[model samples]
Structures are given as C-alpha cells and as structure tokens.
Target: MGQLLDGKLVAASLKEETLQQANELREKGIVPKLTIVRVGAQPSDLAYERGALKRMAACNIDVEVKELDAEITQEDFVKELKAVNEDPATHGILIFRPLPKQLDENAIQYVIAPEKDVDCFSPINVAKMNVGDKTGLTPCTPTAVMEILRHYEINPTGKDCVVIGASNVVGRPVFELLLNEMATVTICHIETKDSSKWARQAEILVVGVGVPRLVKENWVSEGTIVVDVGINVDKEGKMCGDVDFDNIVDKASMITPVPGGVGSVTTSVLAKHVVKACKQQNGL
Candidate 1:
C-alpha cells in the first residue's frame, strides 16, 4: 500500500492556525467575516454553504448565507453582489457557482470586487495569479493542492508533472502554480489524443478530469505521486475520484484519496483566505 496523504489532518492544523489568527485580529478590533451568496435551493449549493459555514465557525470567523430566489433576474443578482463587495465589514465574498440559467455567469463574476473575491473567480484575480502576484487570492482547490504538497514536503521543482483537466478552477491554476515552482508541466484536457502517454511519463500526476476512475494504474509510472481532485459517485453510489485508487495505490509512492483528501482541505483553505483578507483589510 502507498502512503496516504490525509487532508483531514492537514486541514485541522490549518484551521487551528486560522483560529489563532482570528483571535489575534479580534484583539485588534478586527472581525473577519465571510459572506456566501447562494442563489436558489440547489442541493449541492446548500450543502456546500452549510459546510463552509461550519468551517468558518471553527476558525472563529463570522459567516452569513444570503439565499436568493431562483427566479432572481440578472440585474438583481449583480446588485446583491455589489452590495456584498462594497461592504467593509464583509472581508470575503463567495458566490456559489452554476447560478440559475436565467442569469449571466460572466457578468455576475465581473460584479465582484477583486479585494473581497475570496473564491478568486473574478477575472482580475485570475489575471493577477497568471502574473505571479502574491497580492491576489487564488482559487481555494488549487491553493489547497499546494498546501497539501507543502504539508508533505513535496517539492515540484525540476519534476515532470502532468495535470489532467484544464478548467479555470482546478487544472489551469494548478498548472500555473506548478510552473511557478519551476516544474516541467504538461496540461492535458479531454480533447487530448493520448492523455495516458503523458501521464505515464510524469513524476507527479494531478488528476481533476471529473470523470470517475478515468486514470488507472497503467497510466502512471512507478513511484509517481498522484493527487486525485475529482469527486464523482461510482456505480455503487460511493464517492470516488478520477484516479482508480485500488489499482494505483500499489504502484504510486504517495496518493490522496477522494473523500479524505483534497475535498477535506477546500473549506479550510476558504477560511484561511478569509483570515488573510481580513488581515489585509485591517492593515494588520
């Protein structure tokens, strides 16, 4: 069996550190707050909001969930976003994704102020990340991936890395971070002719393609490090990732499991970003 990279343990440590920072900020009369704007009652959105609130409370951060009607218009959505963006008391803003089809997603993202855009979905923050600026916030999942790597003392510099998936949220940002770390990166997408060809050659492989068990043991080289970012339900209704854990664990040196891996660290990273935004807002 390969070494398991446990995200729950890492996230707990991060939460403890964030809680201490929150207490210190409170001493200076600064309160870190996270405002989650969720439109509609989508089961996934509601579940994520509840989880975020729970984690925020653990970090001693204030959290507010703004539930909007599913019938809300684009104009109204923009107005609500602007209200949260301009609120000095709200240090971080998270707008749940896949809003009702009636609203324009791009326009909605454009309305958020870069400073309070803790999710880093705004174009400004995305641009800042591309330029290698530490001042801008990074998307939580990719940032969490890096945190996991750092926690395990895995350095990507000079390593042959392959990132499967090119979405704005995970694949792209992680690829950029890997480049920043001086790793040789190859980003593969669904359209790629031979994803396994590149995967087998990589010393470190990060899979986020969203298809359950798309990557198997034969796709990876011996002793390679695998990070599975996909959260898909298997045929048996059990949660799994893009990589086939049962098959790859024996061949890989280190690997992260689905439910206990990256998913566990995501909310904690969001809380950490809230604390960082609060510190900057307070000049602390």
Candidate 2:
C-alpha cells in the first residue's frame, strides 16, 4: 500500500511557523492583517471564508471581511477595493473571484495592490510566479501542492512529472513550480489525447481537473508519487479526489487523501502569504 501524505501535519507546521512570525512582528508593534473582499453570500465563498478565518486566527493574524451585495455595481466595487488597497492597516487582500455577470473582472483584476494581493490575483504576482520569482505570492492551492512535496521530501529534480490540468489556478502554476525545481514537466488538458499514456510514465503525478475519480488505477504506474488536488462530490454524495484512491493506493508509492490533503494545506498557505506580505510591507 502507498504511504499516505497527511496534509494536516504540513498545515500544522506552516501554521506554527506563521504564528511565530506573527508573534515576533507583534513584539515589534506591527499587527499582520488580511482583508477579504467578497461579493454576495456564495456558499462556496462562505466555506472558504470560514477556513481562511480559522487559519488566520490560528496564526495570530487579524482578518477583516467586507461583504458586498451581489448586485453591487462594478464602479462601486472597485471603489471599495481601492479603499482597502490604500489602507495601511491592511497587509494582505483576498478577493473571492468569479464575480457577478454585472461586474467585469478584467477591468479591476489589477486594482488590488500587488503586495497585498495574497492570492496572486494581480497580474504582477502571476507574472512573477511564471518566471519562478520567489519574492511574489503565488496561488494558494499550487503552493500547498509544492509544500506537500517538500514535506514528503519528494524531490522533483529531473523526475518525470505529469500534471493533469491546465488551469491558471492550480495545474499550470504547479507545472511551472515543478519545472522551476528542474522536473521534466508535462501538462495535460481537455484536448490532450491519451492522457493516461503520459500519466503512466510519470514519476510524479498531480491531478487538479475537478472530476471525481477521473484518474483510474491504470493511469498510474508502480512507485508513482500521486498528488490529487481535485475536490469533488462523488455520485454517492461523498467527497473524493481525481484519483480513485482505493484502486490506486496499492499501486502508488505515496498518495494524498481528498479531505485531508491539498485542500487542508491551502488555508495555511494563505496565512503564510499574509505573513510574508506583512513583513514586506513593514520592511522587516
């Protein structure tokens, strides 16, 4: 059976490190704070808000949640974001995306200050990340995947790494991150013919396609290190990952579970980014 990559342990370690940094900053009379700008009360947004709040609290970071109406005008929304960006008290900003049809995200995507754009929503951070710039904050989920690999000491250098997704949020950034680490990276998307053929040859496999149990046992080879970043509800209403864990566990060398895997570490990465932003903003 493959060894389970426990995300809770990784989360705990990150939280502890962030907490220590927060405490030190507090001693220097600087309070690290994150502002979450959310429009409407999306259940998915609420769920992520709760997790971020909990993680921030654990790290001794202050959080401010600004809830806007779903029908708020784009001009008004941009005003609110600008207000937050100009606030010295706000060290980091997290904006829930996929705004209402009334709002044009493209117009305001770069409005958030790059230093406070903790989720890499700003194009500046995204560009920095694409070039392997360690100074900028990266997307939380992809960073969590990298953290899991580090925690497990799974070196990607020169390894055959296959990422089963091409999303800017997860797969693409992960591909870049692994490539930065000198891994031979291949990214497969919806148009890729015979994804499994590539997957079977990977020494490391990372899946974030959001399809439940999409990667079957045949997709992975023996001793493959599998990282499932997908979180979905199976037909039975149970939560699951892209890889069918039960079927692939015995064949893979190491695997991450659905609920306790990448998702669990994401909030911690958010906290880490906030702390980092705080330090940079304060010139610490």
Candidate 3:
C-alpha cells in the first residue's frame, strides 16, 4: 500500500507559519488583507469562498468579499476588477475564475495589479511565472503541489516528472517548477497520443485534468509518486481525484487522496501569497 500525502498536515504547518507572520505584521500596525472579487453565485466558488474565509480567519488575515450579480455586464465586470485594483487597502486580490461567459477574462487579466493579484491572475505575474521568475506570486494550486512534495521530502531532481494536465493553473506551471528542479518533464493533454505510456514513464506523476478517475490502474508504474490535482464529482455524486485512488494505491509509492489532498493545501497557499504580497507592498 502507498503512503498518503497528507495535505491536512501540510496545510496546518503552513497556517502556523502564516499565523506567526500575520501576528508580526499586526504588531507593526499592518494588517494583511485578502479581497475576493466574486462576480457570480457559483455554488462551487461559494464553497471555496467559505473555505478560504475560514482559512484566512485562522491566520488572522482579514477578508473582504466583493459579491457581484451574475447578470452583471462585461464592462461592469471590468469596472469591478478595476475597483479592486485601485483599492490601496487590499493587499491581495483573488478573483473567482471562469468569469461569466460574456466577460473576456483574458482582457481583464491585464487589469489587476501584479503585486496585489495573489491569485496570479495578471498577465505580468503569469509571464513572470512562465520565465521561472520568483519576483511575483505563482498560481496557488501549483504552489500547493510544490509544498506537498517538499513536505513529503520528494526530490524532483533527476527524476522523470510527468504532468497530466496542460491548463495554465496547474499542469503547465507544475511542469515548469519540476523542470527548474532539474526533473525531466513531460506534459500530457487531450491530444497527446498514448498518454498512459507517458504516465507510466513518470517517477513523479501530477494529474489535474477535471475528469474524475481519468487515470486508472494501467497508468500506474511501480513506485510512482502520484499527485492528483483534480477534484471531480463521480456519477454517484462522490468527490474523487483524477487518479483512481483504490485501484492505483497499491501500485504506487505515494498518493494524495481526494478532498484531503491537493485541495486541502490550496487555500493555505492563497493565504501565504497574501502575506507575501502584504510584505512586498509594505517594503518589509
């Protein structure tokens, strides 16, 4: 049986570190703040928002929610983003993603200030991340994955790392991080041929495709370190990860379970990023 990569434990440690930093900032009369700009009433986003609120409260970080109507126009959405962009009180801004269909998110991405955009939504931050620059905040989910690997003492150097998702939020950024760590990295996507062959080649496998249990037993290779970044609802309404936990557990060296895995550490990373942004802004 494989060991579970306990995200709950990692998140707790991070919260402790963040809490200390927040307290230090408080003593200096600076309160770190995170502003969540939620445009629509997405049930998923609301659930995540509640989680983030609880997480931030634990670290003593203040959260301001900008809840907008779902029927808001694209121009209005842009205005909303700009409002937060100009708010000097907000140290970090997190916009709920996949904004209403009418809104051009790519265009809005450039509107948020890189320093205040803890979610790394701004083009500048994304560019910085792409070139391996550490000057700006990285996307939260990818950072969570890196934290898990570090906590578990999994060294990526000289290892073959296979990333199974290509979205900017998780897969591509993770591949870049692994590459920087000197890992030979390969990224698989929907169009990739015989994707399982590539997965089987990984000493470290990271999956973030939204399809539940997309990776099965056959995709597993002995001693593979599996990090399932996907959170999906199965036909039975049960939450699961990209890699099938039961079938692949015995075949792997370690794995992150759904609900308690990659998902757990994400909000913690958000708080960490907020603190980072606050310090950078205050010249601390």
Say which prediction, candidate 1 or candidate 2, comes out ahead on lDDT.
2
User: lDDT of each model, Cα atoms only?
Assistant: 0.91, 0.95, 0.92
Of 2 and 3, the candidate ahead on TM-score is: 2
Best by lDDT: 2
| TM-score, every prediction | 0.97, 0.98, 0.96
**In candidate 3, which residue pairs clash?**
none
Clashes of each: 0, 0, 0
Specify the highest-TM-score model's number: 2
lDDT of 2: 0.95
Model 1 misplaced stretches (Cα beyond 4 Å): none
lDDT of 2 by residue, 150-182 (tens): 989998999999999999888999998898898
lDDT of 1 by residue, 1-284 (tens): 78998999889989999999999998988889999998889999878888898999999999988889989999888988888988889999998887789999888777888888898988988888888788888999998888888889999999999999999889999998888888899999989999999999998899998999999889988999999899999999999999999999999999999899999999999999999889888776
lDDT of 3 by residue, 107-155 (tens): 8888888999897888888788778788789888998998899889998
- Candidate 3 segments whose C-alpha is farther than 4 A from its true place: none
Return whichever of 1 and 3 wins on lDDT.
Answer: 3
Per-residue error for 158 in candidate 1, Å, reads 2.0
